[model samples]
Target: MSSSSSAMLHTSPLRRYALLASNPPASTSYSTRAMAIELATLPLPASADASKFADFGREVKGVNLGSLTEEQLKEIQELLYKHDVLLFRDADVTPEQQFALTKAFDPTSAVYGHGNNKTGKTTLSILHPDLKTIPRVPQVQLIGNGMVYNHEGLAEAKLKHPHHKTFHKTHISDEDEEKGATRFYRWHIDAALYDLSPPKVTTLYGLSVPRGGKQVCRYDDGTGDELEVPLGTTAFVSGRTMFEILPPELKSLAVRSKVRYAPHPYVWMAPAHAKSTGLGIENEGLEMSFDDLPPWEQSKVKTFPILWKNPVTGGLHFQVHPCGVSELIVDPLPADAKKTGNELYPDGAHIKDLGAVRDILYKMQRPAIAPNLVYPHDWHEKDMVLFHNRGVLHTVVGAFKEDQVRAFHQCNLAASDDPIGPSEEDIKKWA
Candidate 1:
């Protein structure tokens, strides 16, 4: 980034975060709610009733990726876009094989959730864990204590961000809660920062999961655990509709407040120049502030961008996640707003009432329609589960935690923005 752009994005503490707290909604050809409903409520044909959720992929065969041509690889990318999620059943592939295969879909592949989610396919595969790197970010997210929001990815606040080079959680035996206790997430999305939606397909390979997995234990007696989600089955979540019912507090906050946080494509689209800069921030440094950007460049950023387009229809979807940096963290607000001429956000008194706002936002945790959809993949060896990242909010049940150790070599389907979000873009970069 230019010294100017860096300064422009620079948001030091003291600069109230409410400035960028909320970005206006994006203009999309398709309705986010409608798409959420369609995907979440799609009816399977009578044949589908007898057929398993992923029998389609099993029926359609593909040449072993190890034998595909570069052109064929590109074709597969397009194919993945079409199918959204595909499963590769019972094929002998190693983590290295999985990584290579995942990379085939996107050049920017990254292994995410270093320790929170299992990755190595088998007990032996655990030894072959993928590489880890500290995310360089300007903003810091600290929620309560165990729940911190940082670019290093989600973790219990007290835990040293598992990906941390030196920090590793002690895997306490179940009998010992205090000792081997690693943290658990309260069913949340991956990125909550910006308004950018996720991609169409994400694949998870179940290397191992507990036999008495938590995922499959939901009550069926009058309770709403309809889908008997199984391990090895790649489950999908609906990002936009997870909680379409915006809480009264949030609405009051939204309608009552004139001040708004514009979604910067930096969450998705950063300057092309940054990419060549070695994740950009590293060479130039993350201290780069948004104030450094020319007013004209600032004009180029999008408050909200349609992140997911239908692989087949090319339609857009809404994005809603508990993304941290992208949202205004009332406390420890960044200083970029005051230091600069409100490039990050316009000044407003609305922030004083954030606590009230939190109450309203808390209400959104429920569903206007469905709480959230989990399209479990039952991650068998060759199975691949894909879904629009923007379409849903997904979580790994970690059910395979039983004697059946489950995992596969994995990585974030990387993009070129955000030092910290959905990708290098959605993660932790600033405009």
Candidate 2:
């Protein structure tokens, strides 16, 4: 076994105990939902050696959309909440079938909508422009290297702006310049920049897997390097683990802190460059002063708790994403206060200190990248992985050649209005 793999195994026992202690089995009973056909959990393949965090995921071999029953649907829901991730090997599901599965999880999810297009009903298509949506089901967007190139267009579009042009030329590399254009490289919580609540769950069905060249990444601690055995893998970090590892003092502060996010138009815009630089559109960046933004744009600020309790698993998790957060205020007033701008920051208190707080959060997040906490899913055709957005942060691990057809269909469960803020009771218990 490789050193990284051995290190991961060494820490698995401790991490598993921590996870169990923090996330005790759910006491609430599930409804008597039954499946049409019994679905059985299958043993993982001997070669299947991903996911250092046991219980993070499970592989089930018994059912598909055609054979799905209400009971099986409920069981899948229960599994998703309990494990935070689920893997279905050889899941031969059609786009319509995928849509049906998403509906089973959350009927009102945004999986069926016109997305950004003004006219026809279109789901978000992350696949190559040529890959047409399934005849009647447009909700399933195909994803792969094409989506990555489309992201590059957005980055290049920013070059039209004088300030961005200078910054890119000075700080970004030819390689990074191309990659940064696509927001896929950035680690973030989904739908964080929008006014709407973020998604609760996300599902991905793999159609093609990259093979051959190894994907090498530096350790978060800058200790050395670790190789991603799978060429194109999807990496995930547990938000629960991130919260568990925080320094006691910082944990206390984080549980009480709130983060504010502004409107980020480029979140999923395809051909981003054209839309970003189009007439009447204004480019925005984190470095730009809040006061400089137009009143309407400035009004887009949305606040969320930094540390929140997951109602599903009854576990504490961090909801922070350094890239998406624009400001951090410790112990913010209730929403009724309607504070804005400078009023939001009293005495410029944590103004300069925000970076320090962010650095700590990043450090806490680093362990998730560690072999022990990280789960890099090696994709195989017909494989489907479902994960809870409320408990984990995920990103694409490696780059794929343009010719590689790494198609995937993604679906999301809409976030609930249930308060994310930790209660005094929660802080005492989880802290």
Candidate 3:
């Protein structure tokens, strides 16, 4: 693992935390609600080989997710902000209830992150083939593989789990695939990356999970790095860790850089193919032409910071969607900067060449996705997972057979506000 300086770790006064349930429902006030439930830290997934990510998720038990009160919702939102992921086992949450829990994080926001239920209609979108929205609660989408019948008002629907074979430039042979081999199906933060702000958090409830032997996820980048992952798993890596693991020069560049996304991003990248590792697109010049995209406006295009500040922890997280990014605009070193020598961008530079931009980001971000740092959640029936969208990068791992039916409800709202970037102190300290 790469070493991080003491500056990256936020120092705080320690406080006691425990597993507790409110016997006589706590008051609605923030102070009283704080006592309602304390988030209980849990062990990482059984397959995880390291303890570095123990703070990534907290397990909540004995709570009825379908009927959470305002106070409970606020506490969960706070916990989600601090831990970045929460696990609820054996949950019986409905589509409406799942949407409610997601919206509780951003009260005024009501629409789904991807054009408010416009995925299918926008055939050019990269997300078109992955999600099927629930009819009653448009915010919640029904995802997974195979045919689902009479589910939440939809009479019949065929769901297809995204497979690396379709997106990756070079995939394993069918014989190898049949032998339980797979790849991560695009590492990403769930967002439209256009007009809509990135969602603050996402909730996924597993309805039917296909049970089978573990599969080997091959990076296929010639390093021969591979992971033994559960069938149809979702892999995650912390964005904060992605930022912290960077070398000093890269760290300085990350804090001072901003990423400009392509217009109608998903549609713009529809023709592109991803790398074998699913980190970013291969540079074969297959992206859609700007003129070919649907009617779009310059004002609607997004340009976000390379680093997003965590609201609760005040940590700066490296948050970039590798596939959708078009350019990198970096600021020069501050006049009063403390560090010197071999600086990346001493004078501000705007990188417009797609290849150069992707190469720079790939070198800085790929180390964090090493096997020891990844967390592949093992899904079980009725298991609900909520993750802080801006704080981590995740991907769907492995493919499912057509006959194996798997179903899940997913929800996330386009945030009402844009993510916060680094402060002046952070720039002066790092740059």
On TM-score, the candidate that comes out on top is 3
The C-alpha lDDT values of all candidates are: 0.31, 0.51, 0.84
lDDT of 2 by residue, 1-431 (tens): 97644553565333322222222224422223333443334333233334435556667656654345555666778888777778888776655456656655555454432232211222222122322333345555555553322321122111110112221112223474344221123345655344456676777887766565554443322354343445566666677777877666556656657776644423333222211111111123233344433243545456787776776777777776565454566664444433334232222234334355455456555555455455667778888888877778776555544566565676554444433778876655433
Top candidate by lDDT: 3
Residue 358 shift from truth in candidate 3, angstroms: 0.5
lDDT of 3 by residue, 268-370 (tens): 8889999999999999899999999999999989999999999999998899999999999999999888656868988889999999999999998899888
Residue-pair clashes per candidate, as listed? 92, 5, 0
In angstroms, give how far residue 361 of model 3 lies from its true place: 0.7
Tens digits of per-residue lDDT for model 1, 1-431: 86634542564311111112111123212111211101222333232232223312221244443333344445556554444444444443433334445544444434332222332332222122222222321112111112223323433223111211111122224443222222112233333223322322344443333333323323112335234444333334443333223443332222222212223322222222111101111122232244543232434322332123334434323343322112222212233422333222233333424233333333343332121333444444444443434344454332222133333334334333332112223211221
lDDT of 2 at 286: 32
- Candidate 1, run of 10 with poorest lDDT: 273-282
